[model samples]
Target: MKLLFIRVSLFGILLFNGFSLKAQQVKPDDKYNRREEMITMRDGIKLHTVIFSPKGQTEKLPFLILRTPYGVNEYPSPEKQGYVKDMADDGYIFVFQDIRGRYLSEGKYAMMRFSRDKSNAKAIDEASDTYDTIDWLLKNIPDNNGRAGMYGISYDGWTTIIAALDPHPALKAVSEQATPSDMFMNDDLHHNGAFRLSYAFEYAFMEEISKTDSLYQFGNYDTYDWYLKLGPLSNMNKKYIHGKLPSWNDFTIHPNYDAYWKKQALKSRLDYPRLAIQHVSGWWDQEDMVGPQDAYKALEKKDTKNQNFIVLGPWRHGGWAGGDGRSLGNIKFEEPTATYFRKEIQAKWFAWYLKDKGDGKFAEVISFQTGSNKWKNYSAWPPKDVATKNIYFHSNGKLSFDKPSAKEAKPFDSYVSDPAKPVPYRARPIEETYGPGSRWYTWLTDDQRFVDSRPDVLTWKTDTLTQDVTITGDVIAKLYAATTGSDADWVVKLIDVYPENYKKEPKMSGYQLMIADDVFRGRFRKSFSTPEAITPNKVEVYTIDLHAADHVFKKGHKIMVQVQSTWFPIIDRNPQKYVPNIFEAKESDYQPATQKVYHSAQFASSIELPVAE
Candidate 1:
């Protein structure tokens, strides 16, 4: 056998929460071993898997698996990453595999592979692939307990959920972090019914452009300019995509939340996971906040035995997968959240269920509430003691909890939404998604002041709060809106305005932080599947789900709301003219429109927030 050598750094890397690798070996001991194998699934196709066994383990250890479409060339080592260091110390038979058709794995890769028919004998899916791999590990690996656990972030997290659908007898625990539960509804592909262009396109270009991950080089430093120059969505095929990427093609065919999206939705197809499962999410998780939350809700319906668990922190998409979780953009979370979650929460979650080592006393829901910057534990998400309140939009740009009275002056505020110059989702010269120094991860937390003064973006704010107002649950935006065009997109944002002068953190002075926000494509106002053109210049009630959050508008700070029409690139520009398919829309289809939002008693626009008492 050929031996592989890795450079040793005698000066050890620091571990977390009082844990240290000071006594760790410069290199793995002789008893430690690594091997690569092609594990055969029930369908007879093989998947590439890499296994690592602990050095000189005293007893039998359970298997911890991570299956991913992203290349699984290297597994985490205690000497390097703090994310899995605790699990390493606990002595797991760590296994990582490239899922079907990805990297070295054999067979065709499906973007979000739908579950197979369980009644059929020859049925195969990611779940079956997992079952087959576990069967192989238990029989072939040495000194292993007959139990297994699976955990991963993002797409890997989705695969972990696949395992829970039709689990092998030995697969006893799962941890899914930042998983995309649905491609269309509230995950990566779309927010509500609006298409996510840059992400969906770039991600496909990388994932399916040749099997091994590839990157799309944007023509301009600012992708906003490149996308604008490309004109309509149809140019995507004419210029670059050109029928090669399967997912992009799928997007062109299925623009609505129709059968295609429903069939692939894991939230709808889920069965009660009988084994232990932990759902993790980040408050600012730009990618898949809807996923874990939706999955948790689906499982909650049948969780009589209490096997479901969830964690939410003030981090980005898979942000807690590494780093100290100190802060994002200009916001700081005094909580050492990522470290605590990995060391005390995620690691021990697998330990309790897989190894039976400790009492699984995890709270049903664990959340790191921002603004006040503290951690919360509850028997149920939203805590049940929460109250519902609406922050109403008032005349002359004011926000108040009190409802609008009949005596108020003007009924609404109006703005011009020009497709020619759509509002930039972030500060200008916006980098490509996943590009070097890209602020995409923390753009949601970016100071809203950039868009606050724009004529297209209208704002309403409240006076400085006299007391702490903590919001903790699903947030909904009710808009009484009118657009001059037949179609439009309504964007609503809930902001936390900082005091103008803060001596300690001078950078955050007068910061306008976004707490919860979402967009609703006007066509989907009635039904997501069957869209209808609006009667030009008529008012319509568009209710947008701003999603969930746990935040506080502390004393001396203000609560603000901003409404707008277009969020470019991130959300493909809505042509404002009704068309059968946005992907096939032409340049002539794009138009400028006057948008109005009402604050009258008859059509009071407001945000319904879940306030925790």
Candidate 2:
């Protein structure tokens, strides 16, 4: 139920109604003065707002809100709100809501709701409905300069981090973009504990069993053979969502990470320091890249004052609000980075904290470094003058920053996985992760030579890199593996390769380019709310985080890594053996195992990386 898939371009916000000379066009008696309203929510629940305001602008302006459970009636036409026409020339009163139910809000629609009695006073969440919609827009709208700000992207970026947790002193500044602080460990329906079965069954049949939000059809356009013949995850409630999806019956009754998914993790309630955050992410954000870097490291461990910041781009998932992010699926970043972050970083970050105008100063970490395409900044995010390194894994199909020696003699690297022939996270007829020739929003920059001649995959590479390495932050992977069956699913990628008489384009030379990947679920490898099993042939280690990255590689690039075990039907088919409830296993709990992977001097698998030099 965590699918906030709004890729922006609402038909280019209903055909761009031109007005950009620092924008200001609404009068003609306030051109159809768009207001809408419902508001209310201190427990009487109403919330469905819209607002707009600008007319002859005499000053008192600053509201920006956004909240959203996805429908503010699709901008009925305040000139179809071009998704904030680049922050409408620094004057804002905008608003727009919904968040309470699915559409014209009211109440009773809880999925990731969680506020069940936080010391009850009729407690309702999404941060008290964003502090009662910023106390009814600073007491019923009208020339509002009472300061308020909020931003969104994915699930309206989780309703702008639940409206900065307990904010409203007239809320003040926030930006979440691609949010999902934790849907069971990563985002959009489990990652570390696996189970992302075709994005939790076509995003629970397009948001809870087609209650009209459409797109569930697939009688066949190869969603990899309709999720491999929709087999088991208990045939999605015994053949096509029969329980009428209460979030797929809470994903077949919470398959692990307990306390109902750790009370819907908002990353330990992001300690708001008088709010003001930025947090947007996307280093190929195929979905909440660990929710705005774990809510900016849990608000930088209670951000003492730096008002938490982070930006990370190199687009995908709300790809910086509609293109010109200058290259993605073929990787280019030659500027235009989403029109320079919507004109110099999110319109000068809400015109410097909701309009004191400009100089609010940025860069706590503003990343965007894919293959040396520039834009760096960094004062923190994994950049304490980095250097962790590691790399390793040798004997025959090398890849080494050195380690693994003890006179190497065939360490380990077998294969065989076979859950009835799996491993195809891509390349097949594939489509439909949501309509129209979908490469599911740029399959995280495809080209890993489509699973590099998969013989049950397991690559490892190196040699060719003579200079520029420059990694820059987080990417673990570790792994010391073994798996004759007892449950498995490992994945791990990290590629790069490129260079083969490479001239600017020549079809990207040899191209492998993945740059980071993950997937772990071997019985949650020791606890994602406990699951454990593999003793079959022992050897377990399995770290896997492959998350953060800034990239660079270059100078005759090479760097590869791979290692597989079924990424099929997009992760969901780990029935190697053990089953407490892999959504009620069965179908002979799938089979075939024999995985291996070591690289000894006492099992040393490796990846680490941070580097930056």
Candidate 3:
């Protein structure tokens, strides 16, 4: 399901670039030619690859490659080969390849293939396959410069990072956009051990079960009702999958952060410093936002040459790849951020590295401020000059930075988390994740007011600020909570409350715009790899990483926090009871639990924000 959105996004980029090129009267030059061939890997597996180059040029040009599992026919037209028609005048050979076992390639397909031991002769991973392909291209491709560059988004982005792990001599600069760093920890599969139900299930059905790059049809249009009635996670197989999806089977067998999932993580191995790397992602990216950020942080530890950089925008998943990028949902960014990124940032990065055409001055970290609608460059991420501030949750639905007085009596709040009445991640009548009219792509930025009034959701907000308050780094929610059941799930949302006098729309008044949010499964609090039953009625600290962000809470605006147990249809219900494997839990395991959140001076439940001076 997530991959489908990525494919659509890439296609949109091609169309956008194609139209922009035509608008500028750029025509396909007769000097350029296109050809298709099968690139053989070290293990003799052949991958379908296409090459586009200048036909009659005497000077050799650099080669840029994009390897993807979404098939090489994504563009179809030779003019739209690289989706960089704007940079066609710079002159470089563009190469696109279908990953092994995806389309016209050979060998078995494995999701997030673990890096193999290079000493083993028969071991073939994406890194080895990429090294072989680059070696072949440098030797066989005509009129090619000694250097090569690799870049891609989403799944292809993952391949780009993998290729950089053990790059060939010819591989120089790499840009990995929205790369999935750790599926179980953050990315598409789960969020803090909470399984992404709609995304993971449908994605497995499409990629593993159907064996095709197509969306699975759901009988009902309202996926909210459909998934709710589906009952337990176990019914996915009993009703439709029938033990067919290998991914789903794996999900059930390894419910914890065991060796199987740990091996698939890429962050631990992102220490290569030989290649110049640029990590790109959106702050509001519906998928894989943590991937690029985490990958950059990991590489920074060993960035001897200071070659790793990060770029974050106010776009959704792959949103910077196309569109005007002026706004998402109702909020406006007040600029053509997408255009600036594509032309000034992205194209310039490639031109400087691949062509050596410019001074190559790029920031270590470039991020956009959402509320303020401006781009800011930093010498380092989470800027070293920032101060950490904790916002406490207070009584009577109030939020404050000051510590609660010891005189206060009621220092805790409680709510009922009913499994049968789980709160929807978005508004009611939720659309399918991958099909027509699906709102899954932009649900992150949806106005959060819908769930604010629900009794099960506890919301706290600060008084209208007299001055703007800006937060500029990672956001962490430190919650002291207890559940009556043996297992539980906690969801925390950071939102920006609009001023009531705003004239954009009547509904815009007091609109709660979600800034950052994430979920944490209680069983994995002690250790992700090991699960422990929650001692009922015991207050435990659960730290939920809402990832990174740069946003401003305007004067007269309010900073809001909403906490809940269940974000249904999106994340599978926890059953609120101890279960060995959620995917195997029965209907009998589903039970309601009373949840408590303590905000006393002893146990100050608060959100830590990195605030710049």
Candidate 4:
């Protein structure tokens, strides 16, 4: 009896230890079916990747890849996470990789490093990294069909595009969301030449800390108190410029759009190999305005497959992914549109590409037609039937399609812009951090009510139109103005005023969405790199090209145009001293400047609208 007891106890111990070992190797019954592994690049850099394969037994499956600076395990490791199980259960493989130099990946991380052209051939381009990863996975992973798709949001979006440019034949499709094509056009830095300070600093602050390749803890800025009370962007940097931050100093040092920015821009090189694509954007994403839209337009021009598609929703950032489709904040859409994007549009895109179920649902260009508040689809962007129109600024704050008469001679509105107290360009009276950092741009629609009241903002409006005027395509503003100061910034906002009695529920009462608005820092009139300040009080005609916009004004609604000298925080407060790269300018460079805008027939300031007939 003693010998039998000892044998039974020893057998139990062995069985328990074996079960623990197996559990460590693979969790039992994981829905996502996640597996962590490392893939070594050609140059010995090992990339950390978390892969999700189909649960249970399955045949060869389609693969989708997302390479992100943000960690892959943010939530449920993609596979086990909401709706992702559909892909896994439906026999699809999902892979999330930490980009080189980021967490769990080998090598030093550099900002915007993966997209640069390799003249010396020493660097690892995003394309090469993608190629190597795919090659390794196909050989090592079981049941892969040798076909893959790439999809990403923001930084990951950049890689998706870069991969498409020099793609592997096995890469069949790509879906890039809010990815910047040109780093300069509408990404992090300059828009038309204005310095995007607050947007740049906070973005870089988080990105810089994410590089430690370890766990990062972020302290709340307490938006209402700390960041807002910090006064100016310069002061915020002074307080937060601890040794850990990298991109902050780099951005502050290079205020002007110089080679530093040009090197990082994807526009310089956008030659994509043959691949189907779905590019996306939002009407209210002020920070990354030109990325997915620009990519869609460019790829359509160059791609031979004729397979480019775009979806612009009425949301901000990546709002379409996890949010409801209804209107946000003050701008109510009356329906839940975000649900359509995620459960429907996203799934359809993947199905069309991976499963070869081409439903033709998203084969066309999809954009939100505001004012009308409906979704419109076209074979291509701006459609083939659109037309262009020019609305001129007239005397006494009037705007009209008719050109100013030769007999008309009216002086322009003038005001003094003080850098110390620059006109607030960002939506005001709201929490300071709300506009740029939060979801405040929805209320900030095309409405110019707030800007029209500013002393530095010049308002020009037209009488209620007798007939409807529809506009489609790009918006170009020709400015005929001069300044008493050597340097100044000019902001142009093109607005569509609602009809006198146009009413919604009480919740969305005050929001009058603008059609389009843009700003240009004047010193870099000709070239972004070299800025030439204006001669004091000299009359000069500068062209402020606000990017493309699509809108239609009903008969009762009026059109308005506004020009302002400053838009604080959005664009850094220009010193008006004509200093080189306002980022490095000292306090002495800051000064008050007087600005004037002309509207006479001789100096006609007008907006050239691409009118859709």
Best-first order by TM-score: 1, 3, 4, 2
Q: Look at candidate 3 and give me any clashing residue pairs.
A: none
The best candidate in terms of lDDT: 1
Query: What's the TM-score of every candidate structure?
Result: 0.95, 0.38, 0.94, 0.86
Among these predicted structures, which one has the highest TM-score?
1
Residues 1-613 of candidate 3: C-alpha lDDT, one tens digit per residue: 1122222332332211112222112246544577788988888889889777865667888888888766664444334433465455567888888788777687778767888987898788888888888899988987787889988888888999999888998888998989989989998899999999988887766555432364556778888888988998888778776777788889988899998888888866776567899999888777788999999988888898979999999877777776678888777888988878877888888888888888999999998888899999998887788888999988888898987777646788999999999999998778777566677767888889898678899988999999988899999999999999999999999999999887766668888899989999999999999999999999999999998989999888999999999998879999889988988899999999999988888888899988876
Q: Give the TM-score of candidate 3.
A: 0.94
Q: lDDT of candidate 2?
A: 0.78
Candidate 2 lDDT, 92-140, residue by residue in tens:
7787787776667877766567755768787888878888788878888
lDDT of every model, 2 decimals = 0.85, 0.78, 0.82, 0.68
Q: Point out the higher-scoring one by TM-score: 2 or 3.
A: 3
Please, what are the lDDT tens digits per residue for candidate 4 over residues 1-613? 0100011121122110011011123356665577788999877899999888756645677789988776554334343343343354455788888888877788777768746445756567788789889888888888887788988777778888888887877888888887876666566567877767655654555456555322112233333233334444566456555445666677667766777777777766665537788887877666566788777776677767677888877766666655465875556666566767766677678877877765756646777766566777777775778766778888778899888877665767788888766666545543333222443445445355766576877778889878878776678888988888888888888887666666655433333566677778778787877779789888788887676555667677788887887776667777787876665567777788888888777888889887776
List clashing residue pairs in candidate 1.
Answer: none
State the lDDT of candidate 1 residue by residue for 52-91, as single tens digits: 8878778999999989877655444543546677788778
